[model samples]
Target: MCPLFSPPLFMQRYQFVVDFVQAHGSKKVLDLGCAECSLLKQLQYHGKGVELLVGVDKDSSSMKTRMHSFAPLSSDYLQPREGPLEIELYQGNVTQPDPITRGFDLITCIELIEHMQLEDVERFSEVLFGFMAPSAVIVSTPNADYNPLLPGLVGFRHPDHKFEWSRQEFQLWAVRLSELFGYSVSITGVGALDDAHTDVGFCSQIAVFNRKPSQNDPTNQHRSRGEPTVYRLLYSVAYPSLSDNNVLQRMLVNEVLSQAEQVKAAWLSGEWAAKMAGAREPYRQGGDICVSLLDVWACPQVKHLCGTLRRFTEALVGERRVPLTPDRQAVIVPTEEEDEEELDEEEEDEEEMAAVEARCTTTTTSVATEDWEEEITHSAVGELTACHVLAHD
Candidate 1:
């Protein structure tokens, strides 16, 4: 009755979801788009051990199924029931703002995304994220490449489907999400579900979003300003400088702040016509920076990244984490790590090939962890808010 996630590879994911919710030791689960309420039944059937099971769907037919049973937990919070387990199923669409009754330990939206309207995707995503029980959200969706091999075979393939994504496409989004929202993401599983009748294999992609712990600059050990918010991306936390010792490098450019102020004031005062003697330096001097984040947390990008992470940390403390930056107005600051000496078009291509070869040599190489880089004790609080695109240039 729970998810027939019958595949051998997926058993790991089930264990993952179970262990994830048990971290905080709460027993409430809400399944959005709970079609046929199979997930609820599974919890009731298998989760006689699970804390709470709540299922929701928009189709009225979902109520006719044997899984629908509700008991009042209070006037507003009602415990659901199914078989020997306490389960609940509400016939309502996830698109509505008020469909969910309360927060849950883990919120799951599995394989049902393809059927929703393209525009509603973001809206409902936020709504669903709001329903997350403050721990983690486990999501599984179709890898766009897993499209039907024969289009007209079954009703499963819809011509009006909005868009699809490949592995890289999903990673790009995940990277951006983590960067923008300060959430940690890891791909949990990738598998193919075969619809033999259509000769098509639906590729399932799963990702886990875990909150990390809060940390502060060892320098500012006692101050509690909460986290800093970069209302607007003013700078890149890029390589501040390319030097052998990162601290020395940061100190060397300690003058950049004062110097940049003069430059910005000049540029902002309609005095762009006049150039300062120090303004001779070109934009974005690219390179490497070897500073450890523990001691100094003053750079704009560093501040933004860490501050956001702190908020997440404060939110999910003690929840459990296996463990695991920012923007620019327009100034392009380049760093030395990437400034590996550019080559002409042909030479550049060769360099890339050699880099790839070197990469292959160290493919399985691992590094020794320093004391500070050991197991984490802090936790982060974050929700997988799909994409908060406030502006585009």
Candidate 2:
């Protein structure tokens, strides 16, 4: 028997929700019936502008076991969150009214309503649309219309599912609830079949409900009514971010210095190669090369620079060790060995002066001085190791 879908039905469902949340720029989001917290994990990484995320489920043990997955990783510290993010998981019944979950920008109930009893489904509708009324809501359930296509499949998709609704049945229920609660509803689906089986609709049906304002609605009274907390907090995490001034500066300085060193090392290698080939020095100064800002950004090691390009460039320039041209497009990198070379040249000049003062210099002084300068040049070039150039046009 073949698997139901190529990319898998669960992944498609999560992608659909992620796209919607990101496009809408929803700040506060709640996921109802968030089993194993799979959807929550995806949103934390992919959902833009989502500051607060909450998950509600009845399974406490599973949530606790999976909580460790949300911890900060090494990459997370390297590239901290753009803004503050908090994720909280609660163990509670969806049918019950909770004041804490009110005024959310978005709420998702993926494949959840089908598992509750018929009575509980009604209670959940009232709780979600009336008391916990959010700006928008998303619900998904198994499509009974597509069941016949599955080989040897009988009844609902899962044993826990109380009822699987056909396309017409799900639409009718959604439309009725929307009218009663002062909301607009739209129906869509995921996990589609081939053109031949298009009439059967999708394996999973989705309904998106958006609340509408009313002059005098009974549900409006529940807005101010404070209800006691019923859901037990299972797990909570406040993500680390670069919002801290100290953290931002510290990380920025480290990366700038690291890139500067790499650029300087590359400059030294090229100068040494040119010298060995009997060509004039490739670099203008003592192994110092000029690199464009674009060249610095192109390096794979600098790809993790956390903030905007302009902001990061400003921080890079502020490092003091990295000196940029007046145009700010390129930086002049001086080789580490250049300082030693300058000291050597000064010492040589001082010795030559001392010999002349002694009046013991012969007619061969000019040739001998030339030979000594060549020896010093060779010593500096031989010490350099080969490195790849980070500079580009």
Candidate 3:
């Protein structure tokens, strides 16, 4: 368990979203489904340059509890009588047009989309992209393919979650939404990886979308309809920024070191060696073991360790004189004595399998080869530990 100032995997995701939001220099921020206003509270503690923070949720009772708790706190930045926090609480459904005014710089909906029915996601997107028209939007949800990584986990992560999407599924949806909304998207993950299933890695995934400036221009087709008065403001208060502690910084260092150790252990255990031997059948049948292993190794969190493991695997394969089929040219050709019909059938099957494998290989290799600074900077670490927050503010 992580300390109050250092959140675990699930909470860490909120930090990532907040970091992205802060990096964009957003002032007016709105969080959809802001249950307990926990995310807003976190921002108050760690965030910089945020001027206005608005939180909306369907549960009015939770909003009341959060508002009441923060109302009494006083500081140089926040006065109890004057209410200096610049925070607003609203009870409203996120599926509809946001009740707040237009031109919000950043909007976030974390772990909320999966609760909606599959068919309703489109409408939710329309409201978010078309009606809200924020400069940036950050969304996150559970990664279904990653469920196997969780110990004793069964079914969805939450009972209310309508569906958990696989990486491909989430990517497809993000791509479609980006096209429809004129936004560019980047996908990343949050969570620890188990050795048993490192391919999919993270338990949760996030998609950050930056709406094109041109799309917000007057001539654009999808213009915001201004603000609507749909939500009742529960209260407004001032929340002071909390001082930072070295605890979070230390915890992140420990986490990175722990992950590096895990990668080393996996490699030293001869797991990759065994996987390399298994590659023979797959490679001959037009599949790629390297590509599959690369998916697990490409994560930024363990890139250095992964590099060592990758080199070790390649070295081991070389020493064993193992053949690696990189493409069709490397595949063994059928002999002239072989039956024509049987050869034709085999070729057809191999071609189809090769096509699919080629796509996977291309993507995995690109991620593996992308240039990233070997040294981790403070900003980078801050991004990595985005969920860490003070217990109170």
Candidate 4:
């Protein structure tokens, strides 16, 4: 079997993994539940300046790998990374509230929730919010509906995973948590799943979350009203640079996506929908995770492997940040020849029209603020209205 099937020391919800590194400026990422610290290593280049990759896990043996055991929760550099990284490995349960978690722009939790009891997740998410800045987290888990037992391919199954949730079940929790905590949630996929058949332990999401909202939001009345299929794809495809200018790029990308059918009906063909449909809409669970395919595709490396699909992902990312003009139209070219033609077309169009494209931040970005309002008005509003009466459990 190819090594690609080999899971990381810890399961990584890939979509979130990218966004967290990209959004948090890559400098101060807290890799909670990090297994081998390999994932943290992958993120090393993305860090901008004060970049620090902190990997936390309870396994003492993980300490031996290429990282330093995080110094006990202290302001000083806990195990500094051997390279430019300031990676820290700590013997602690990220699920529990710790002062060390704060100041981070992004957080990652991939397939770790299944190992914890439901009651533990309830408290864990609570603690999770405490450690993060108001924006940006990426998480993923199995879609229970597909597996009925656990999502994702089998064989990695562990006795510890408590109750694997269906896509719906996970989202129920995610939506509630977003409402309660004031974060925006989006989702992506770690690996593709079979919709016609079922696979046990099949991965469901590459969920992303941002505690703080982008200043330029995407919530026009029309934003959330679309057929969610394309939007989920759009979100992932444009994520890496979308946070530029504080997700001004992300919002603009969604804005274009909102009107993509106008660009061409073929882009929205039934075959396309069938291939890209989500097991769940906005697939974020407990409302704290967000998704972006650009985040998925923007490996700063993986683009080569995904090939033409990579270009589709890149074009999607560019469309969001590049401002449209009264005269300019986004050309769709599904072929290599068309791509060359489009570049030629862009130059001709560039001189003819005024570029009103949005200004994006250079730092890694969280989700847009409009999604914040959507979470509030749609799901969060009702959930927030619920009185915080203590649960009997």
Per-candidate Cα lDDT values, in order, are: 0.40, 0.69, 0.57, 0.43
TM-score of 3: 0.55
Task: Write down the lDDT that model 3 would get.
Answer: 0.57
List the candidates' TM-scores in order: 0.41, 0.65, 0.55, 0.44
**Per-residue alpha-carbon lDDT of candidate 2 for residues 165-237, written as tens digits (9 for 90 to 100):** 9999999999999998888999998877589999999878999998887775533443222333888776666
Residue pairs in collision within model 3: 15-386, 15-387, 84-238, 85-237, 85-238, 85-239
Each candidate structure's count of clashing pairs: 22, 0, 6, 49
Of 3 and 4, the candidate ahead on lDDT is 3
lDDT by residue (tens digit), candidate 4, 245-356: 3233333343433333222243334222211333111122232222234333333222432345445444554453343322232322132233566577657644432221
Q: Model 1 off-target regions past 4 Å?
A: 1-26, 68-85, 99-101, 130-133, 148-161, 178-182, 190-202, 213-393
> Which scores greater on TM-score, model 1 or model 3?
3
Comparing candidate 1 with candidate 3, which one achieves the higher lDDT?
A: 3
Error of 3 at 263 (Å): 63
lDDT digits (tens) for residues 1-393 of candidate 3:
222123445457668867876677777788888877888877765666776778888778777666655442324322111122367777777777743635687888877888889978988888888778788888888788876644334677655668889999999999899998889999887764446566885666889898877833522333233343777667665433222122222222333334333433454355533333333221213222222233223345334322464442443243211232344112222213557775686587557534422332111000011011011124433433112222211
Q: How does residue 174 of candidate 3 score in lDDT?
A: 94
Question: What is the Cα-based TM-score of model 4?
Answer: 0.44
Q: Please give the TM-score that candidate 1 achieves against the real structure.
A: 0.41
Q: Name the Cα RMSD for model 1.
A: 26.5
